[model samples]
Target: MLYIVSALKPEAQAFVDHYKLKKSKLNNFTIFSNYNIRLIISGMGVENARLATQTLINNFDITDDDTYLNTGICGASRSYTIGELIECGGVNYNGIDHIFQENRPIISCVSEEVATPSYELADMESYGFYDAVIHNPAIKQFHIIKVVSDHFEPQKVGKEETKSLLFNVIDDINKIINF
Candidate 1:
């Protein structure tokens, strides 16, 4: 199974449309799923991401072959173009760094939305998703994939733009999942 956690509906809409997933309520979460994939909207924060991810974990039977992914849009520096895909190799949350992969960008998960480029990349939910998923022993494969939606100006990002950014990277996301 490929379990996905996205922070907003717009972020998850790309996958739901592409996969033809059906919407359903899972406890307090809004989940979209088919036979092989389960995607959840974790809302827009670290705590929300943790709760939503934990809810999914509590209801599912995880295996070594199952893959967990946290996909969403992020605020990045001008060096990254809008709509660019970033497979975060590590996440920094509240001053703690957790490395997942090597030679890739490190995303700083913040408690609130950022308007300035204080970090190379910033998002509201990655660390929360990571916090929940890291504790699970049955799952082995996991990834945090983020799309650049703004150059530190998150206010300019709209629903349509968010959907478009993620839609463009569906194939890339699949490649990572299959890898």
Candidate 2:
């Protein structure tokens, strides 16, 4: 079974609308399930993410064999044009090194071991969840998928819009699931 995790209820509902899953909640955690897929709208922030993930794992009895995904929107590099979907190969936190192009300084993904980092180019959560739950042998696959929502703009993406953007790409998400 695949366990999908998102930061908001809208994103979760988007998946539910398409899949037509059963909706249920546990201690305020919204959950939806369809066949082999389970989606959880975990709210926001790393701490909230930890709680949600742990609750899902405990309640659903998720193990290492299940696919775990952290999907959401995030800030993109200034050099990266808006509306681009970038896969997170690795996450680097803390200070980012400047990339030089045409004598102009450009910010980009930091070159560092995924094992060690402080701040990531993208991702609001999953680090804590990965760190906490990844040691189990039952976990077969873990992936981080995110779309660029803004170029560090203050604009907030409403629930409906986020649903439209994410649900439209279910094929891509399914690929990730299959992978």
Candidate 3:
């Protein structure tokens, strides 16, 4: 089984609607389904994202063979154009670098340690998820897929605007995930 997480309903809905997914409420959590996929809409930010992902892992009793994907929009360095989908070559947690771009979709790096040399852009829970899941040998692989949503301005991206940004980048996302 593929385990997928999106930070908001809209992001989850993008795949849900596209696939004509059905909604189910298990316990108190919401679940959406595709033929071979199970999606959880873990609310925005890192704490919520972490909790939601953990919940999915616990509820489904996920094993090592499953793939965990944290999919959503993120801030990009100025070098990345808005609306581009990037399979994270690495993650810069605060400032500590962890490179994961072994053989996936590649992104040009600005420096040896920096994955993308943008200013501090925040996505709630990817680092924790990466750190937690990658240790499991049963898991074949895990990576983050992010789309450029905002440059540096908060006002530049509100909720509605983010969904719009996500919609525009969905095709690129498709290629990124399946690539």
Candidate 4:
């Protein structure tokens, strides 16, 4: 099974549309799923992501082949173009950096939305997702993939734009999840 955790409905909409997933509710979280792929909308922020991810984990029967992914839009520097896909290798939460992959970009997972590009990349939910899934022994493969939606100006990114950014990268996301 390929399980995805997205921070917003617009972010999850791309997968729901492409995969033709059916809508359902898993506790308070909104989940979209077919037979092979399941996506949960975690809302925005660290704690929400953590709780939603943990809820998904606890409710499911995880196999060794199951792949978990956190896919969403991020605030990046000008070096990254809008709609660009970034497979993050590590995430920096609070003051510490946790390495997941060896050499890709490190995303800063902040508690609140960032208006300025303080880090090379920034998002609100990666670390929370990471913190919840990392401790599970059954989850052998997990990935954090983010799309560049804004360059220090998050107010400009609309719901349609967020969905489009993720829609453009569906193929890439498929390649990563192998589904």
Error of 3 at 65 (Å): 6.2
User: If ranked by TM-score, best first, what sequence of candidates would result?
Assistant: 4, 1, 3, 2
| N/CA/C clash count, model 2 | 8
Comparing 1 and 2 on lDDT, the stronger one: 1
What residue runs in model 4 are displaced by over 4 Å at the alpha carbon?
A: none
Model 2 regions more than 4 Å off: 63-65, 93-120
lDDT digits (tens) for residues 81-115 of candidate 4 = 99999999999988899998998999999888789
TM-scores for all candidates: the values are 0.97, 0.76, 0.76, 0.98
Which of the predicted structures, 2 or 3, would earn the higher lDDT when compared with the native? 3
lDDT of 3 by residue, 1-179 (tens): 66777877766777776668789875556889766678788765555666666777667766655678888776656777787777776665656677777654332212222244445444555665665566555666566887777664545676766677777766776565562
Rate residue 124 of model 4 by lDDT. 94
In model 3, where do residues sit more than 4 Å from their true spots? 26-28, 61-65, 103-121
What lDDT does model 2 reach?
A: 0.63
For each candidate, C-alpha RMSD in Å?
Answer: 0.9, 7.5, 5.1, 0.8
Instruction: TM-score for candidate 3, please give it.
Output: 0.76
Q: Write the per-residue lDDT of candidate 1 for residues 1-179, one digit (tens) a residue.
A: 99999999999999999999999999989999999999999999999999988988899999888899999999999999999999999999989889989998999999888987899999999998999999987778889999999999988999999999999999998898793
Local accuracy by lDDT, each model: 0.92, 0.63, 0.65, 0.93
lDDT measured at residue 75 in model 3 versus the true structure, 0 to 100 = 65
